[model samples]
Target: MKRYRQFEPVLISGFKILEWTHPEHNHNHYEFIFIREGTGRHIVNGHSFPYKAGSIFLLGPDDQHYFEIEQLTHFVYLKFTDAYLCRNSSGSTSAIQQLEYLIKSRETHQMGFQLVGEDNAIITLIFDTLLLLRKDQIVNQELIWFQLFTVVHVLQRNMPELRSNSFKSRDLQAMFCYIHKNIYDPNRLRI
Candidate 1:
């Protein structure tokens, strides 16, 4: 029941179709929402976007957002903290790279069409990770890190547009800082 924040990188929350409705105005940690079935509309920063199966929406820290379900939807919500991303894994920073790009993008960037065919695989992986996280089994940190990277890799491979711009460490840090400062107050974010 801990609220998500930048200090803790992962949160596993599940929602059924009937539970879908407007949230009581709050910010997010790094968020990944996967719609397994049905359809809905996501309202973020005054914009209403359509959400169907396989729809993946990424919300950075402090981003005020919510969803209204139009059909029966099954989804998993993952929220991770920024501090968790800064930790280096082996020699590669793929997780950091993926997270930086995801956070830098606009709130609610769609990944693919409804959760069908290949997209179902990604959804399954996400659900699997959520279950693993919930279990809290004693395991190597590296394994957990790799699991996180895999999620990012799946997302990037699925949505080429999200991987378009290469980012430097400083740029990503600055972007995250800006998001942290303005996400709660959408009026302050010009973009």
Candidate 2:
């Protein structure tokens, strides 16, 4: 299996093709894949999930995936490095720890994000704005981070509700709820 390496901090790119040319591969950076159009099965770690226009997938560094296209597919990828995520917390070790805890959670991977309901419009707008700013080479760092964080919060909020059995311990469950409940308030989520 091939493992891809990304040298850039962030990247937003789009393409349309009738077939998936790349083999199943994992990358060093995190990825948000937006299915702009078409239909297909997205195979991730040997699991296949059907996808159509507006489907969005979040891939962590360890995830291996590829598309099995059934129709012409249009893809837009938002890739970013860990450094980009933790850039705001220059010297805060807990920031990185918290990021790794939430982002690397195995359960989160099981619930692939969607482009559904009101979130559909919000996410679409963010992507469109980011793409336009990226094209113009005039991205406002704060605005980009704000948009990305907003997307993350939306994903968190919409995650399927977990029962007591879902978590190993009561404390863990509480932490999860507290963290997600106050996601927009950084001070409240500080570890």
User: What do the candidate models score in CA lDDT, each in turn?
Assistant: 0.63, 0.75
* TM-scores of all candidate predictions against the true structure: 0.66, 0.74
- The list of candidate 2 runs beyond 4 A from truth reads 90-102, 136-139, 162-191
- RMSD (Cα, Å) for all candidates, in order, is 13.9, 9.7
> Could you say which candidate leads in lDDT?
2
Top candidate when judged by TM-score against the true structure = 2
CA displacement after TM-score superposition, residue 103 of candidate 1 (Å): 2.0
Model 2 lDDT per residue over 1-191, tens place: 98999987778788899989889999999987878789989988888888887787888989989989999988888888978876755664554554455577665554366658788878777777777767743356666666666667666556555333455578888988998899999998766
lDDT of 1: 0.63
lDDT value for model 2: 0.75
